[model samples]
Target chain A: MMPTSPVIPLFVAVPLAGAFAIALLGKKTRIIPNGMALIVTGGLIAFSIIAMRMFSLFGVHTYKLGAWPAPFGIVMVLDGLTAFMLFTVSLIAFLVILFSISYMERYSGRWQFYTLFLLMVAGMNGVIVTGDMFNLFVFLEVAAVASYALVAFGTEKHELEAAFKYAVMGSVGSLFVLLAIVWLYSYTSTLNMADMALALQAAGSTRVALVTGVLLLTGFALKAAIVPFHAWLPDAHPSAPAPISAMLSGVLIKALGVYAICRVFYSVLGVSPQLSMLLMVLGVVSMSVGVLLALRQWDLKRLLAYSSISQIGYIMLGIGIGTPLGFMAALFHLFNHSVFKSLLFLGSGAVEYATGTRDLREMGGLGKRMKLTSAAMLSGSMSVAGIPPFAGFWSKLLIIVAAVQAGYYWFAIIAVVASMLTLSYVMRIMRYGFLGELREKWAGVREVPFMMKLSLGLLALICILGGLLLLPGAREFFLTQAARTFSVGTQLASRILGGV
Target chain B: MSKERQPGMTLIVKTVTRLTVGLILLYGIYVVTHGHLTPGGGFAGGVVIALSLVHLMLAFGGDVAFKTLSKSGAAVLEAIGALLFVGIAIIGFGWAGFFFNFLPKGTPFDLFSAGIIPLCNIAISLKVGAGLFSVVIAIVFLRVAGSERE
Candidate 1:
């Protein structure tokens, strides 16, 4: 392909430059900062769409940096999986930035908020696109640090406390990932993903390799907020600015955690029965436990954060099944969830914006005040719950079918239970926060701004059409090629290295 | 929001504190860059920066020291450091004509010996120093904000 395809690096560059500019120039004019950030997000969405088209037309495209080969130089690989992720990341980023134009008016330092938000987008894009391991770690830290600051942006007691806690846990997670990178470097004597994969295959299975793989898995698991290492997420995700909360719940964990694990394990480590089983166990546990914890949360964001954990469980469960159909389902859910989850969080932001409260009990009949936000939340909740016709349903169905096909009946039951719990919480929000009798204190509240409404509407539209991803053409363009990329395994090493 | 500047000797202590912190920060870069060849890496270098900042903050007090250099400043630095590290790795893609292996060789037993290793160390130090500094500043600064954000 052409040397300077805008599809690959644009995702990272746009956000990085936007972030820097927002930080420096934003100090004076909030309007320009917000406008610049929105423009970046819009450009990213266009880039993601380009990547999607490229993947569909060309299969997998590798962007070799500085016109270099691979294994020796850094390469950015754009496959179906990456394009899917890019599409999701950019779409959510665009919407979140849109929502923030209005949502952040309540918070001071609009420039700071926009700057951090753009940095976060750049980091996530970097993670999704870069084909280098060290590159991945850097992006991971960038996104993590930005998130830490964004979480504490409110600077109130709870926001600070949560941001500090999130920063500590996240740093620990990053440390683990860094250590894993060190170990991988020591094992394969390489820092590139494809080269390492080839080396691991050549080296065969050794105790050191096994240990390193386990460490990488554990570190990424913490990042993905799997059951065992998920304590920090509930505290962290809820405390951020609403747009930030949406971004975290929507894409951050999936990109930094889920996407990394899938890429490393499937392509680098080469999935085995043992590793697959381990993933299954983790997925099942996270699914069950996360939902159970979320059931009682009266705090709106906290409950949604907990639900995010449970949803991640579903994504993992499907991907862990180790079938092509299962992989497809997992990637699909990842896309769908980003849509609905971001929508839900944005809806919560609107509610928070108008009512100045997050407690469900304090909210009542907000549907009257915020018709668009309520409608968006209701649609998002349904989509998340796997109601028929919504995007969540198709992915969930595929996962259940794939599990059943894999002969894991018990796991299917777990998936169903998780689905029910998801429905329950989403329903609770609609009933208590949106539809119930009007509360006395919040009666004077009004609808959120036009930008917020527009973003929510766009996301809601995506949630409704999420199921369309399963159609053959969409599947071919977005997900199948990614699954094929992972399945291609060590061949990716040769492809990047020019058949060295 | 305002602070009474320390009378005199304490101010000297503050001056000593700032210089000491700056020196430590300089030394930290050396250790972190030489990590692959010797010992220490990004994490260790970053911690040293935080330690130096803590000393300065204690001697100079939060207001006076924090004003010139804010936590938000450190946070942005951390992010930029991360971006720089990733950016270098991307640049390495040119040499091997690929994304992930060591080039033919650099200088063999020189300051520029390990092609990407030194660069990696430098990037890590930046990220770590800024990261650690941001964390410390956030924690300490929050204390003056009524300590309720928890």
Candidate 2:
């Protein structure tokens, strides 16, 4: 049996404590909530790294809640994929929290923001770690509810409207997920995902399973904002305060949406060829449609939001190929997108903080005045546009290679064209938002504070060097292990059960 | 006549609320404590408790409600309640394991049985009661503020 670690529950516990503490003590002093959020997210980053190390030592560690054995009670599984997701979520979260330190000064009710932010982090951590399907659903709601509240944090006309629309669609998606879980529970007679997988294997694929898969795909697609279900994202993402925008576009969608879909499809439901093909089609549509919509946008954050959909499409397309290489590429892109996109969002926040505008036409020659934000934006844009020597290029290259190897030449061509489209809009952002003549009104625009700059600089550096993760030494412990977890598929159940 | 004409409802509703709100709160506590053995638990009991507070607000209006509990106080209580729940779960680590049920298990029907379950119920009730009441107060105050802005 894999030795149970007591530290597993702390992943969810620490953040919950921080969030509540913020609510209670935040009223007393502003610094308390700020310090509390930083410490909690920073501590989580350390814990995720530790978890990654633990996975290296002991392949899969399962912590059964209430000291109960698996298949009987709720279990938190710490595997390669879980560690990867935990690290990604906590790392970006810490940076975003840091970026918010000065960025949130203009807003009222700072405590509420920190409280909700930590709650969302806790929920994502819970979703990643939990081994039970229903437990995942609960955490998913926790994250979703917090995001809805955060989206309306500004209390503006558009903010409220976007939040309401987002909430309605999110609730509908959650209902579909809940319905799928109910169907799965009825069919498999188990709540534990590993146990359910074994049960489904024993029973073989049924019509009920097929229905459950379709329902789950639709639900997660809505969460991930893939193509048709993406109406709310352009509105909701930009409506939030910028740090939240970063969280929403950066890790939230991937953690609550893409990560859940991956875990459920690969490990639990077992990806079928038809399912793979369907995912590819959706990915292509999301890619082409997202950028086409983005090309017409002048609002800075809104364009980035649309670009987020496009990037998520790339990740999804990588997964759709259904090879070990495909899994690796998807995961790499997932991590890379989280970094660069959050950086971009934070950069936009800095610009808005300085210039007080999100419209691209209103900004110019920011490259002269706001040197740090401009540089960060340049790095982020370069990374996202698949330029050489940046992280995005490597992942996009791998994805294309994977597609070509899989004999889907059309998919490879679509990915290439999408990359070119990505370059065009990103260049537009640089040209209009930064490169041109300094606007008269923005002459006095100053750089953001130290903390925001630190966040931006760190993320920009990562964006530039993110390709090093694919090197032989780091690849084994990080990406390779995560890829192997998915490649094994239904065998995950047997491994977990056998280990216990 | 002036007292009755205060911003709230008539004296009849206020009198009824004053008398019954305490009883409702007491019953909520009872349900929370006996949650391990009874059908009602933290969530239901907490809702009942919050409803009693809401009952007071609806009868006497927000001024009286704010005086008793206040927005900040309710926030503190909710936070404490949540922290308490998490703390209890953490304390389980010292006994059996993470989230292990370590409390003394007496007879099934006993009020004090299922050790930590009762504690957890109390914590949850604290959170739910305060949280629900605070949400109501915020919305009510929001309307008040909106009017003030106009």
Candidate RMSDs in Å, in order, are 5.4, 1.3
For every model shown, the clashing-pair count is 20, 0
Question: Which one is best on DockQ?
Answer: 2
User: How do the residues A1-500 of candidate 1 rate in per-residue lDDT, one tens digit apiece?
Assistant: 32335458667766876776666557767788888988999988888888878767766677765555567667787877788888888888888989998788777889888888888888899999988999999999999899999999998889899989888888888888889889889888888888888888888887766787788888888888999999889988888988999999999999999998988877777878899888988999999998999899999999999999999998999888989988888888988889898999889888988888999988889898788888899889999999989888998999999999999999999999889988998889999999978888877898888999999999999888877877887777777877776577657666655532
Error of model 2, residue B101, in angstroms: 1.7
- By DockQ thresholds, what CAPRI class is model 1? incorrect
TM-score between candidate 1 and the true structure: 0.83
The 10-residue segment of model 1 chain B with minimum total lDDT is: B96-105
Which regions of candidate 1 are displaced past 4 Å? A1-6, A66-69, B1-150
DockQ of each: 0.15, 0.82
DockQ of candidate 2 compared with the true complex: 0.82
What docking grade does candidate 2 earn?
A: high
> In every candidate, what fraction of the native interface contacts is reproduced?
0.11, 0.89
